[model samples]
Target: MRIAITGSTGLIGTALVRSLTADGHHVVRLVRRPPRTPDEVEWDPRRQWVDTDGLAGCEGVVHLAGAGVGDHRWTAAYKKTIRDSRVLGTAALAEALASLDTPPRVLVSGSAIGIYGDTGDRETDESTPPGHGFLADVCQEWEEAAGPAAEAGVRTVFARTGLVVARGGGAWAKLFPLFRLGLGGRLGSGSQYWSFIALHDHVAALRHLLDTGTLSGPVNLTAPRPVTNREVTAVMGRVLHRPTLCTAPAPALRLALGEMAGDVLASQRVLPRRLLDSGFSFAFPDVESAVRAALTDTR
Candidate 1:
């Protein structure tokens, strides 16, 4: 498949591009600057501009461009940046695709498990209604931004991704070094459920979605099982052969992280109901295997 991707430099995007290209698929990267290579296409979400001609014959589009939630403390301005990056970027991409002479058959627009808020111990799926908070609102707008593509009869799938456990980046990147040095510990109460997926499985599931015709709407990109923060810490320690005894109190997290602490400590036991039902299997369905993969991927 010839796929055009935004945020192609990001954690998941980079892996997906590599995996897809390895499988003999053409991967086109959408960039903010002028196209530096034949494989790149320029786009400006802030200006609501996309070079449509460069995206002429894209078989699919995976919109993953967004400001990193953990990239900075949740200042009001950074929060707005996070919101606009997803909302405006998606809207721009969708509108641009809708105007294309040959729009892609599938648009795997990125969403997040954050949409469900703190799911607590209860397992939430795509059917769950939008949760309350800034991220939830952003997710609602983010998914809705693809209206043009859906209206144009394109297969628009909202891939609500979970905490991607990978070596290069994401939450695990920060955790790996800390865990290796015996400094890693749980966030807040440590009982908060964390739905995580291996980078390989994440890339494969995305490729599966690109071809799966019957799937649409909100499909979670997560492992079959979700583990608690404590469980993850234990697995990290085990994988890295280090001690996991330290603890970060909720008060300290709040003081240090501000509003971001809420998300860090939030308990979300998300499930990939649609992905599982659609027969997408995970290479690392458990936390231990995922941690191992993270280590192996790093090595």
Candidate 2:
């Protein structure tokens, strides 16, 4: 299959490109800048400009282009950037794909479990109602922007991802060094549920979705068992052979992250019910095992 991808330099996109290429699929990267190679297609989501002719033969599209929610302080401008990046990028991709002579069979657009907001301890699946907040609003708009592709009879899948656990460059990566030095601790009251998934499983589940025609809409790319923030700290300490004795209070988080503190402390007890029901098995289904594998150099 020929696959066109946006955000190919991102954590998930990088892994997806490697895996998809290894599986013998042709991959084209959609770039915001001028195309430097035959494999790159120029696109400007903000301007709604895409090289539709270059994407003529794409069999599938994985739209992962978006501003990183945790990458910057949540200033008013940064918040708008977050929303615009997803909404505009997705809208552009969907519109472009809709214009293709042979439109892609599937559009696995990126989303987040943040759409569910603070779900407390409730196990949320695809059918669950979206909760309130900026993140939720952003996700809602992001998914809605893909309406063009879906309305054109294209099979669209919104990968409502969770906190992806990986060795480098993700949330867990930043936490690993601190935890390994025995400086890790629980956040806030340490009771908020943290829904997460291993990077390997995340990529694999995406591949599964690409192959499965029945799966579409919002699919939670999370583990079956969700853990509390305290549990996460304890498990990381156990894995790293360290002790979690300190506490990072809500005030400190608010001071450091500003309005993004809500994101850091939000409780989203999501479940991969759709994926599981579709018979997609996970490589790391629990926090303990997932952390060990992700943090360790060897499997």
Task: Report the Cα lDDT for residue 116, model 2.
Answer: 89
- Identify the leading candidate in terms of TM-score: 1
Error of 1 at 136 (Å): 0.8
lDDT of 1 by residue, 73-98 (tens): 99999999999999999999999999
List the candidates' TM-scores in order. 0.98, 0.98
Model 2 RMSD, rounded to 1 decimal: 1.3
Alpha-carbon RMSD of each model: 1.0, 1.3
Single out the weakest 10-residue window by summed lDDT for candidate 1: 290-299
Q: State the lDDT of candidate 2 residue by residue for 41-134, as single tens digits.
A: 9999999889998898888899999998889999999999999999998999999999887789999999999998999888888899999999
The C-alpha lDDT values of all candidates are 0.92, 0.92
Clashing pairs in 2: none
Off by over 4 Å in 2: 297-299
